[model samples]
Target chain A: MPVIEVTNLHKRYGDVVAVDDVSFTVEAGEIFGILGPNGAGKTTTVECVAGLRSPDRGRVSVLGLDPRRDATQLRERVGVQLQESQLPDQLRVGEALELYASFYRDPADPGELIDKLGLGEKRKTPYKKLSGGQKQRLSIALALVGNPEIAILDELTTGLDPQARRDTWALIEQVRDSGVTIVLVTHFMEEAERLCDRLAVIDRGRVVALDSPAGLVSSVAPEQRIRFRPSAPVDDRLFTDLPEVTSVQRTGGQVVVTGTGDVLHAVTSVLARNQIIAADLRLEQSTLDDAFVELTGHRPAE
Target chain B: MHAFGQILKIETRLYLRDFAAPLLTVALPLALLAVFGLIPATREPDPQFGGRSFLEYFAPSLLVITLAMSAVNILPTVLATYRERGVLRRLATTPASPAALLAAQLVIALGTILVSAVLLIAVGRLAFGVPLPRHPLGFALALVLGTAALLALGLLVAAVARTTKAAQGMAVPVFMVAMFFGGVYVPRFLLPDFLVRIGDYTPPGVQALLDAWTADAPQPLHLAIMAVIAVLAGAAAAKLFRWE
Candidate 1:
């Protein structure tokens, strides 16, 4: 059985439909990404599933329990890390962990979970004293203390530095490896690409695309791009004559070549025959970001 | 039962960390108690009330003040801060119930109020030679009614205040009215007849009813009415409380 199944969820605030007919399933032990820009209903959908909000329309089942009707049971099985949620300023790391753990019937040992999150040395530190990245790690640790079957993380690495972001990604992977189903809400295409098995790209309260990162990118734009700065200006038509090269465009000293199969080999041979030692040469594949912009016609903001 | 205990512990820890507020909670009232209970009573007893010292007349009132401070002044701040900081929202996702949180707050407040009451009573006895209550049952009845009334009033304040700042702002004016008119600052009998009449209609009006309940000569009818008002206010608070 699916660990979480959300069907036709709808929520509106005033005239704004925060979540409009969002439907998805998260399989057990898989990392499911809810990819969307801000105000795209990612957080609302997750909050409804986590029993924080009661949706006006739709059915949500987490571990076969209704999020609203079986709120207590659902909270016990699901762990949630909200985007702007906070602990009290005076609450210490260890105290916060223990207090939350006490709310569960069978909680993970607070000391062990703290150690796992590398917060052992910061146990006595008040929440106000921690850095942003440290606070994020502590929030994740609190979410896991219930020994939950599913974990929902919203904007998991939004404020972290690059190195901290990578460390968080590793921790997420470790959590997934332990057989915990993860529902990651993220706007970062790279995060979705690196971490998710499947993703749903939502826009304006509607899902625009749903597939694996590779599948979505391929489905949107399947061709590969090759670019090189030639020693001398070359005619665009000359590159297009190659068997693998589908199209070519030249502007200034650079040539952009689009190709079908074996494009790299064909382009490199063409370059060699012309005695053109490419100044800046690269082959590129379509990324999730490209698919997102193509689908929504807007670059996602942080 | 275990969950209840855990909630109580968490609430207590949070309260302990707010060192300044609680010290004021305990100290301010005790200072008032010492001033009113000892300073005026040094000379002699009031012959009209059967040779009772002023300290004896006011020690029970200090207990009511302690209860008022805990429920009316302190409880609103605690609830308002939790709501403002999104603590209630966070707890909503946990196994803790709304009812459980309120219950924990009541238990913690009652416990602290009781300790403060004991200290004030001891100080009154040692410093001013105030007599112990002649009727323990009557004093207990008045104490219970006063506590219920203040808890109700505090919860009511929490329901109306949207933010912690608003709650703190509301607490001051409301507390002054409840204290001055409720007969904690000065006994109602000493006020002008019109003001006394108004005080009787307010929470401190109910205090006179409690005072009547625990008076040297007990008054059962007054105690029953005061106790009924306490229950109604508590029910209203519960009905109106918003966990958001």
Candidate 2:
């Protein structure tokens, strides 16, 4: 059974509909991602699941418990790292971790958790004194201190540097390895593609597509590109004539062929038959970034 | 109960770490008392104060100042800042509810005010030789009711203010007005009859009730007004406060 199931969720603030008929199920111990641009209802959907907000219409169940009615119970089982939530400026890192840990019946050791998050050196440092990345890590540490069955992290690495983002991704993988289901909300395609087991791409308050990262990329743009430096000058038309090939282009010493369905085999067969050897041949697959643009009609905003 | 205790513990620690707030809430009132007590005229029994010395008559108002300054100027700003910074929103996702944080804030504020009151009373009796409240039960009742009324008003301000800066802006004018009415600059006994009557109706009006209790003449009317303000303002604050 899925750990979290959100069906036909609808939420509105005043006249503005924040989420509309959104539905997805997160399997046990899997990293489920909600991918979207800013204001695309990713946060709203998770807020409902976290029991932070009640849906106007729809049903949400986490661990077989209704999120709204069983919020108190759900909170004990689910950890949450809100997008922009902050701690008091004067609060120390160890103090914050200890305080949050005290809320749970069975909590992870805050000292070990902080050390794992690379915040051991900053234990006594006040919140206001920490760097942005440190603060983000502390937020994640607090979320994990409860030893929750599931963790919901919104905009997990939005402001981190590339190195810190990679570190966080590794930490998330470690968290999942420990048997905790994760629901990650992010607009970064690379983050979703690398970390998420499956993704629900949302746009304008609706799920446009739900699939694994490779599945999404292939579903949107099935055609693959094959590039190589031809041993001898070759006619680009020779590649396009093949049934599997769609278009062919020649740039400098490289021959580029774009096609679907066994294009690599068909192109190589043609090159072999033509008495020409293809050197440094490489096939490039479409990325989630490409799929996101195709599905949403715009690039994910930063 | 466990979560509430944790929140209270952390909140108290953070509150104490904040030098400016404690300085204003605790030390400022004592400083003012000491400054006024040094004047020989303030130590003499005065006909204007019904034969009580100025130091003794002003002692209750000084205590009220500590409570009012904290509730009006400090409490609202801190709570509003928490909301603005999403601390309350963060707590809403935990088993420890945001209401725990609000309750913790109230407890901490009242706790600090109680400490300040004790210190002020000790200093008044020791350094200034002002008499303690003769009707201790009435004095305690008036102090509790007065704190509730003023803190309720502060919560109302916190509910309406969108940001910490806005809270501070809203709190300052209210603080000045409350201090003026509570006889911070001018003693209530020395105020014109019309001003005194108006002052009697304000949240700080409890100062008059405290004074009456200190003099062993407890006034039911003053206590009733304070209780009414406390209930109404408390209800309104609860209704209006938002987690985010």
Give the candidate number with the greatest DockQ: 2
lDDT, candidate 1, A39-134, per-residue tens: 899999999999888999989998989888988788889988888777778889998899889989999999999998888999999999998888
For all predicted structures, in order, the TM-scores are 0.89, 0.96
Candidate 2 C-alpha lDDT tens digits along A1-302: 69999999999999999998899999999999999999999999999999888999999999999988988898899999999899999999999999999999899999999999999999999999998889999999988999999999999998899998998999999999999999999999999999999999999899999999999998898889999999998887898799999998878888889999899999999889999999999999888988999999998887
How far residue A139's Cα lies from its native spot in candidate 2, in Å, is 0.9
lDDT of 1 by residue, B1-244 (tens): 6667877887788777878656766777678776765466442688744466655655555555666678888888888877776677777777876567778888888888778767776776677676555566766666666677777888888888998898888887877776776667777557787886665545534444334433554456545655676788778777887877
Model 2 lDDT tens row, B1-244: 9999989988988988988778888898899889998998998888877788988777777776887788988889989989989899988888888889889988888987898878888888899887777778877888888888899999999998889999999998888878888888788887888887887778757455556545775577787888899999889988988878
Docking quality level of the chain pair in candidate 2: high
A114 Cα displacement, candidate 1 (Å)? 0.6
Predictions in order: chain A TM-score: 0.91, 0.96
